[model samples]
Target chain A: MVKSIPLTKADVLHLLSEIVDPEIPVVNIQEMGMLRDVLLSGDSCEVLLTPTYNGCPAMGIIEQDILLLLQQHGIPNAKVKLVYAPAWTTDWMSDSTKEKLKHYGIAAPLHSSCVNWLKPDQITVACPNCGSEETLLVSRFGSTACKALYRCNGCKEPFEYFKCH
Target chain B: MTLQEALFNYLLRLGDNALIQGHRLSEWCSKAPVLEEDLALTNMALDQIGAAQAFLKYAGAIENKGRSEDDLAYKRAERQFFNNLMTELPIGDFSFTIAKQLLLSSFEFFLFRGLSQSKDQTIANIAAKTLKEVHYHLAHSRDWCFRLGKGTEVSHEKLQNSVNALWMYTDELFEMGEADEVLMEAGIVFSLKEIKPKWLELVSGILDDANIALPNVDYMQTGSRKGIHTEHLGHLLSEMQFLQRAYPDASW
Candidate 1:
């Protein structure tokens, strides 16, 4: 009889890194920091996820994808739980993913500590296209709930800024 | 009422407030003055709906009933709902919506801040998560109030009228009843008395910045906690509940 090794936490992490966020195709859940923790005991795997935003529509899809990916990896009894403690912040997003987001034409979130949502007018978001600091907020919300719409005064192009929460 | 029952009722009030207000905001999805503003309002609506689901789900669990969030939201009769009267009012115009947002978001900003420290872990968790969204919502409406209040004669008149028209229902926001008192005793809920002063201060500061006068009113509307609502709520419920009423157990 041939014996197969059970999946470890590192193995689970490696698999999760492949699951792309349906909303932002360029970034995976791991890179987005939505995948918080994984507990694997035998074949019963448990995954904990935190939504990037409280009402993020992508949560359901991400949960399903994680389950399917785990199942495909021969862990059929995996459970994905959504938690909201120490709440998910833009600061969790990896630098590489932020670069990928900017390259994808959606300006990534500024570091959480640097964001002052209260004084939005005082905050300057450089345009992804022209790299100009003269972008004006067209709206506090954008195409997605987690982003803000901004128009570049220099480039004269409208773009999405991944807002800090 | 027993402590459990009181807590259940309290949760309904919180959930219903969010659900009804979210429904009203969704009405502006395609009708906003600008596309960006349309998205913003709808996004806020989504946030409220999500919050409502969390609260209602918790309420159902506490009731020890088989009911789910949808069952509580769509299956409840108009009289069974406990949302505030301000939430059921029609979204008359941009300024009207802005005026409503200003009042409710300010109220929620403080309410959630208090609830975040509640003895109940579930309530505290939900409150802490929601407070983040409420912060942005308040800021959005506050800035708009400033812009519209100082924009032009027509804009200022519209906003001022909105404030006056809605002021009658504002008092009911702080009207705590037996359920609230019971929950307050249990530390499951906090007194609105504490939130009232902070609410007034924050709202007044925004109104002052907006150059809008505070409405001078005496006779205030009430009864939402007891499920007594304006005529508008029934109509709103009929439209909102239409889908679930027609196709039971439908899911995407």
Candidate 2:
């Protein structure tokens, strides 16, 4: 058997960049802000991941992806640790990531989730297809925990909105 | 109660409430009034399940037992559960669910806000994460209270009746025991009584706005402190734990 070559923390982080969100396949986990940090110690490495939503089933798959990637790279004793202190926020997502989501037919979060829940009518998301701000709230829940359903009056298309939080 | 015992019991209460409530909400899947509402209820169910997992996992650790979250969840008996009485009641109807959720979410809003500052790091972390999710549940429930409570006369009457029927269980949500007092002294948890006023104010605001009157409950149901639960819990557990019980240690 060939001897395994160890990967540095940076190398592991780079490899993990390829792991995409299982539900929203358009963007990677890193871009979605679920990949928080990576720490290497001696022969063991730990990846810090913050879940998008505490109940998101994608978290289990993300952890499996991290372990699989590490094993493929011959990294030993690597583990994924979920941290919830500061709590994941939409503010961690960049504008480009938002654009990617929009291009994928899902309207990105309009406001930072840092803002508290406002009245349902106050939240106005632009339709990704028609670029019209005449979208109506369909439901606060969508196909996944991270999305909310919306309907665009301009194009009369129902779309998923990446929920702010 | 010792701090360890108090903390463990407190976590059990939190976990059991979420798990039972989630199970009830999940019963609405594919059965809600509409598709969007169906998805919404199940989404809430998913959030509560996740929160329940965290709390139960921590509780198992606190007990220093070999049991995992699944063990605590699937292997436990009805008498071992510590969920609030309100959480275990049968989902009577859409109006009943909306009324119950309004009360439950409002209480959790204040309860979690207080626990977010917990002296224990694990409890604090779980509370903070769950607090974020609770915001949406609270908002949705509050909005529905208005929709059902102030809609047609039939809708308004249904909601009012649900509130009156569920009023007795509401007090159990705030009832305290030895564990609560101990946790409060240790700073691991704040007094449920401390947040009762806030919980009442929030609930009363929605009820008042929706034209639903404050329920005049003469006496409140109790018993979660002693691991006692409604008979509904036994039946719920029987169905929920059937697979695990029938196929012990079965792996997917």
Top-DockQ structure, candidate number? 2
Question: Chain B of model 2: TM-score?
Answer: 0.98
Candidate 2 pairs with clashing backbones = none
For model 1, residues A79-114, the per-residue Cα lDDT tens digits are: 998787766778887788889999999998887677
Compose the digit string of candidate 2's lDDT tens values, residues A1-165. 544347777787789999999998889988988888998876768899998777899999889988988888887568899988688888778999999999999998866643555354566689999999988877778898778888999999999998877
> Which candidate achieves the best lDDT against the true structure?
1
- In candidate 2, how many Å is residue B46 off? 0.7
**Would you give me the overall lDDT of model 2?**
0.88
Task: Tell me the spans in candidate 1 whose CA falls farther than 4 Å from its real position.
Answer: A1-5, A115-118
Q: A-chain TM-score per prediction?
A: 0.92, 0.92
- Where is model 2 chain B poorest over a 10-residue stretch in terms of lDDT? B222-231
lDDT of 2 at B125: 90
Query: Chain B TM-score, candidate 1?
Result: 0.98
Any runs in candidate 2 off by more than 4 Å, and if so which? A1-5, A118-121
- lDDT of candidate 1 at residue B3, scale 0 to 100: 92
